[model samples]
Target: MAEPTLHIGRKISKVRELKGMKQETLASELGISQQAVSKIEQSADVDGEALEKIAKILGLSSEAIKNFSEEAVFNIIGNTYHDNSASLNYQCSFNPIDKIVDLYNEKVALLERLLQAEKEKNELIKSK
Candidate 1:
């Protein structure tokens, strides 16, 4: 039987994917090239500092990344959704609609910041 190896890079890649982040985005955040990010994903092990930085960028702790298991996640989802008990009550901490509104507001704020940056860039070009 082949021994199972602890692939930290794969865990980081999976977490980044789950968080809806692209290699380019993660690369930019980490101040590394996209190719470097790709290499990291293919690697079996990453150093402690790099792993910590990647974990932070993925919005997770290093321990979370180290302990990540796809099977556990699927099992949790299956249990949560497959439960048919009438007394099984699941209450969300926040309203879904409110979360949607918050996302929209954040998007609008990002657009505004982008517009401001573009305007400043144009002003600089005009002055040159």
Candidate 2:
């Protein structure tokens, strides 16, 4: 069986491939080594900055990476619940839709921050 983390790595790699980007090209754009890019695409643990850079390099909004990670975690939890049904009881007291709404709100907040930062940077450059 494949590890859940590996599944997420594969998903990231798939997205990069869909964008028609090579790992070497992305690494160069991000100022990181190709090996580092490979590690991230493979779902190895990475820092927040690397995640942000990878998203940017892949022509994705940071929110997309955030949402992808959250969805991957949700899938792992769901799969574990089903697989461990014999050993544990899973109760759903909250609606999954509510969680989705919350996540969407979080994504919105992140995008707003990014937008604000860009605006500030632009203003600074104009003032100079």
lDDT of the candidates, in the order given:
0.88, 0.74
Stretches of candidate 2 off by over 4 Å are 1-8, 69-128
Name the lDDT of candidate 2: 0.74
Model 2 scores worst on lDDT over the 10 consecutive residues at: 3-12
Top lDDT model = 1
Give the per-residue lDDT digits (tens) of candidate 1, residues 56-116: 9888899999899889889988888765554448667699999999999999999999999
lDDT of 1 at 120: 100
Task: Supply candidate 2's per-residue lDDT for 19.
Answer: 76
lDDT tens digits, residue span 14-87, model 2: 66776788889888998879897788777645467766777777778655754565467568778777665455
Candidate 1 off by > 4 Å: 1-5, 83-128
Q: Listing every candidate in turn, what is its Cα RMSD in Å to the true structure after a full C-alpha superposition?
A: 13.9, 19.0
The local lDDT score (0 to 100) that residue 37 gets in candidate 1 is: 98
